[model samples]
Target: MAPTAHSAVIAALRAVGVAPDAYGPTLNTAQSPRDVDVVGEGLAGEIRAVAAPAALVVWDTSDEAVLAHVVARNLDIGVLRAFEVEGLLRVSPDVPAGAPVALLATQWGERRLAGLRTLVANRGGQTVAVAAALTSPALAAVTDVPTAALASSDEVTGVPS
Candidate 1:
């Protein structure tokens, strides 16, 4: 059977020498706003492990509540909401040039990859790290960007491998 996203994330954490159990409880207990969806298990841990300290985490607005909880927990972490461009969510142009950027996503698609590439190019070619619940071949094809696949399927869309 294909690995579930939750399992994938745990494996990735182990591969990095971080025990998933170390942060699982902390994330599970995070207090998120009532209106926004909470980030799934393993995702926040992956972000904490993969993203550099002080890196600006760019994410979909729908994830604001949980991501905010993450940022609150880690005072050094920063966040930015992806902005709409041509009806697709793209990295915001306001990200400071040369700032380390981490894309925290629940899924990957052509539009998301395009936005990442554009952000990289616009930011003086600094590679952007990605910590996502679901990934695709297109995401893997980008050899330069570092990524952590934190889940097997798109939880929001129920798209399984």
Candidate 2:
């Protein structure tokens, strides 16, 4: 069966860790992107456990690497660059039997779960459950002990300022 859009996105992310050759691009560290995605904040330090010093951490929140990958994939590569996407859904391969770890996403996040689930399964994790929000009574009832949830908020303290 064909992979879903979410799965495809996940595949793209897991595919990003580079086998960098010599003569790589440099980071200023002072610059900022006008927008960003896939904020894997702890990935660099986490990667140190598995990689040598020169290994390229592709998920680093740097525009140059991010843009390069985006262009290479011919994917939409801009900030606040919104669009509606339809995704295929399928049972993840090699999901651990009733594993507690799983994906929960909506909008963009939901789209990436397809690839992400495979990565999770590879890491001995299981994306056993997923949902966009707690608004559904069925979801709320079933997810009494959900391990993680994701959302944005206008509820931030200074947001209305």
Best prediction by TM-score: 1
Tens-digit lDDT string for candidate 1 (83-141): 65676545544566676666654445656556755765565435457655555665576
lDDT score for residue 141 of model 2? 41
Over 1-161, each residue of candidate 2 has an lDDT whose tens digit, in order, gives 12353233333333332222212222222232211133122222222222222111122234334432322232221111111136422332333443444232221122243454455555454443433211223334434323222222221111342
Q: Least accurate stretch of 10 residues (summed lDDT) in model 2?
A: 75-84
Question: After superposing candidate 1, which stretches have Cα over 4 Å from the reference?
Answer: 1-41, 51-53, 68-75, 85-93, 123-125, 154-161
Give candidate 1's total backbone clashes: 2
| Structural similarity to truth (TM-score) of each candidate | 0.56, 0.25
In order, how many clashes per candidate?
A: 2, 8
lDDT of 2: 0.29
lDDT of 1: 0.48
Q: Candidate 2: where are CA atoms >4 Å away? A: 1-38, 42-89, 106-143, 147-151, 155-161
